[model samples]
Target: MKTRQKNSVQGRTPLVLFLALYQLAGGLVGLGLCLKMIPALQQPSTSTWVGIVLAAVLYTFSILCGFLLFQVTRQAFLFSLANQILQVFSFGVTGLAYNYVAGLKVGVGVDFLTSWVFKLKFSLSSFTFSVGTHTGASFVAVNLLALVLLYLLERAKEAANV
Candidate 1:
């Protein structure tokens, strides 16, 4: 009996695997951040250092994730291109979602603290973070452009392979 080799060209297993791992890591980190933020928000006398540390951890994880994505995708031009494109979309959507969620969380936290911790009548007006609309749109555009470039690169690779 002879063993046959399977084709690796059609199905994007490597890409899928990389994406899954990235999402899993991101999800875990986000969950942890949410948990930390909620507790801090609930405590009226929470230390500013705690907030700073949490922000730093979130930033570090974000940077690490970007590096990991780049490392994983660099192995294949096609995958890299696709990822570069998808990253833009992902970032924009994630940013918007984060903004909305964070705002809600802050409001809830303030309310919880006022009612439970402080036992004072307090009304919080606004909570703001640095995410901007222009930034998200720019990221989306860049990703779309990268996808186009990746398509060209893949085509070139195919031609070369032939």
Candidate 2:
């Protein structure tokens, strides 16, 4: 019984660790991207400020979600799930705001939702990777994955209870 308990605890360690790290990294990336737009805020309109605020809120949720997930508790899983759902909606709003500011005629239609690209380039001595816009189907997939992870964590907790 002691050995079984130990193994079960160990089994959960990696998943918890991965979730924590993923959240932290995601928060940092989001903050960085938001910072890039700070300069554009100069002489900005109300719409731009609104966009910035929306981005800030979304990224803050991501960071908090990451921290909560690190707790490795059932409560944390629930909170993370809620946060992920909010992030999904906010992501769309933020994208639309930024797109409008940038004068891109893109809309949240099927084409915008489904298009995604990731490219890698290598030279004799250097390697480079490039990705499409920050918001798209790929990001939606990421959010969906996070939601799935939270569900898995919830299941794991339920199993542990059993």
| Best-matching candidate per lDDT | 2
TM-score, cand. 2 vs. native: 0.54
**Reference-based TM-score of each model:** 0.27, 0.54
Residue 127 miss distance in model 2 (angstroms): 27
Best by TM-score: 2
| Predicted structure 2: lDDT | 0.47
Error at 133, model 1, angstroms: 14
User: For model 1, what is the error of residue 129's alpha carbon versus the real structure, in angstroms, after optimal superposition?
Assistant: 6.7
Global Cα RMSD, each model: 15.5, 10.2
Clashing pairs in 2: none
lDDT of 2 by residue, 1-162 (tens): 777556446545666666656666666676666777688666986656765676666566667766766555556667656654443221232223221111001113222344544322111111111223244332211233434655765665565442
Candidate 2 segments exceeding 4 Å error? 1-12, 87-109, 112-147, 159-162
Reference-based lDDT, residue 142, model 2: 23
